[model samples]
Target: MATPSLQDGIDKSGSPIELLWQPNAEPWLPEVVDREFTGWRQEQAAWHEGVALLNLSHHMFDMWIEGPDATRVLADHGVNNFEKFAIGQAKQYVPVTRDGNIVTDGILAREGENKYLLSGIPAAQHWVQYHAEKGGYDVAFETDPSSAFRPGGGDPKLFRYQIQGPLAAELVQRAFGGPLPETKFFHFTAVTLNGRPLRALRHGMAGQAGFEFIGDWEHAAYVHETFLKVGEPLGLVQVGARAYATPSVESGWIPSPVPGIYTDPELADYRAWLPLFGIEGKRPLNGSYFSADIEDYYVSPFELGYGKLIHFGHDFVGRDALLAAKGSETLRKKVTLVLDPFDVRRVIGEDQDPGFVLSYARHRVESGDGLVGVTMQAASIDPVGSVLALSLVDAEHATPGTEVTVVWGEHPGSGAASEADLGFPRIRATVQAAPFNEHARTLYRRDR
Candidate 1:
């Protein structure tokens, strides 16, 4: 029997928007680990003051791409500069549609000779795999779906753990019993802890100096235990799923954007290859920013503050269109919105959600001038002590401290004016610079 594809599901749903705007079984992070170890608030502060252990083994999808033409397959699809990508380095790989609309972004690391691993959401993997198969590239892929979609309840192929915060380096060195290797920002080095081989990527999701340790599943327990024991005195707290969702809120990374794959006639074949059960086929498009046109939800990479990653020197998918979009005044600028405290008391009450539903809703952001932007992901960050919302708005309103309003209720059918219903109806907000953490914005990217 032929496997159901995204195209089949969309056909039955009537439109791509209908296929996308349905209930989803997968929320951002599944409950593989406890939602909290000590308390969400304490876990939230760990990464800021001391160190944090993040169990990322279950939530993200990983795809291993290898073979003679692996690099070619990536170069033909991604907008990142290949000349600078070397073994032990990584990039925030951004893939786009032929029209230059963003498909999604993933962390792509060059792990071996002519081999790479792309990790994060499934959107980029699906896109790259389809193109590779169609182009007949001499490349192969082995996928490890996030625990939510992994078949059977068996163990994952790899285990990923991240030690983050200002004191992450101290924790890592102490655990390793030696001075850590000199690693550049976004670069990784092979290291052995308790005689088990692992790759430690210098990454900072919290916008702090940190290391993401990736290794074989067999050695996962050893690494976890070693870190827990070694990091106890240093005030390391294990971050649960509850607090895990808030890191990106302060880091300025927008994790989800509607991929621009659906509704494009040119991508019909691509859609047919996408599984009906995959994230692309079934993820819910909740929130107030709605249009019958699926294209309305599509975002350009430039709009999400990824213009620097687009390498014009390379000819790839969406190159010509992106070249045209480079300086266009219509592109939206991503910013941080600090929800008003007075309105919080009046609307949703004092106990704002601590990222319980981070990227689920697409709330509408407006100004007195009229509709200006859309809030992508929002959460109550303890460190910031504000309900920070990541939004994309007009250039004119992108400045810090610009007053705006957020309609806090979900529209009935997720359409613009479907209906009004929620705990809170409206809340006022102020535009601010993204990466609300100064270290994240300035010093986090530096390799000291």
Candidate 2:
């Protein structure tokens, strides 16, 4: 069977939110290069011990926006400030609905005066493309979807590789045969590797010192092999998708959120313009936090811990809503919830039972009688010795020691089981700091 493209599966009979949670639908899985290379345990340990090379070329979609009005178009549509966004600088690109809810976010890299590269989150790319086409912006866009999901398993426009850890800098230095360039966080610089020029972005997903190397797709093999040859003596381990996902849990970055464009009647035109088989239609929402009203699923930048990225210096889509949310007493803060060891053990133990499945789906979080928040990403990191989840909770329950309950197990309505039997398992959880790993917070971005 041929693989489905982003526009192949459209169910316009219902809202996008409703379609995502449709009963008996297939569970959503991220497109990855390889599920596992060595093993998740050893790959997870590589980031802390020596170094890990992660192949990011297959999972993310890359979009290039170039022209005179690219910056203006982005500023008008997104919530981020581009005043100081220099040629080589990059930032967490965030776009929101008119009501100030998050549409989608990803990494935005300014390649030149009128050239920008936006990678990740296809929804965000579509949103940008929609606005640029109709908003009368003098911008042209070229989108390159992930290789795994793209037709015919073709090569991507660029091959992205991340080398991260305590020794990542040393490896880069050795690869270049000299000192590494002075690149600040979220910044990129040009470098020569094997006589081929490439751009190195000073960024790390695992909360460690690292550089993301990006160049023409043709150089992918040479660049990858060169790193392996130079990094063999330094104990470099190639990471797989299994371990690549664990870092986000420790770093407190929420990977997925329901796009906010569903419920708003004002966005009906945009919805109609979108193809049927895109991320909105295909991505399934599983977990314990099932809601009839789609608005309940909407999240603001403040709730996602992106308050620092919002600046009122420029007029943008969600500026007013964000301004009001900033000063409001009712603020939802993002925090890490540490699952009780015993509860975790119970969930794991249940896996042995017949007809039972263990899911890492986001669950509903409760404080007392009220549903305070919802957990986003959950994972078990062996190094941390605890199963951690990223959650957005009310300010009252955002403290480190505040106790809460995470409703684990898949709900029957979520299509994991028949409707007659709903298996709702409540697990004890304690609220902790956002970044569960202290090293990720303190040393990830430090200059060595």
> Model 2, range 1-448, lDDT digits (tens) per residue?
6544322333433444446664334433346567667777788888877899999888899999999999999899888889989999999999988888898788999999999999996888999999888888999999898865687777899999999988998898889998776888889899888788899998776577789999999999999999999999999899877678778877877777778877676776777777656777667776777765667778888888788788789998878888877856676888989888777777755533111122346578887656888888777776666678888888888989999998775554433422222456778999999877787777766752
Give, for candidate 2, the lowest lDDT window spanning 10 residues: 351-360
Top-lDDT candidate index:
1
Per-candidate local distance difference test: 0.85, 0.79
Residue-level lDDT of model 1, residues 143-219, one tens digit each, is 98998888987788999999988889899989999867888888888999978999988878767778899999999
For model 1, which pairs clash?
A: 287-362
Where model 2 places Cα greater than 4 Å from the true spot, the runs are 1-13, 22-32, 351-360, 414-423, 443-448
lDDT at 318, model 1: 94
TM-score of 2: 0.91
* TM-score attained by model 1: 0.95
Q: For all candidates, what are the clash counts?
A: 1, 6
Q: How many backbone clashes does candidate 1 have?
A: 1
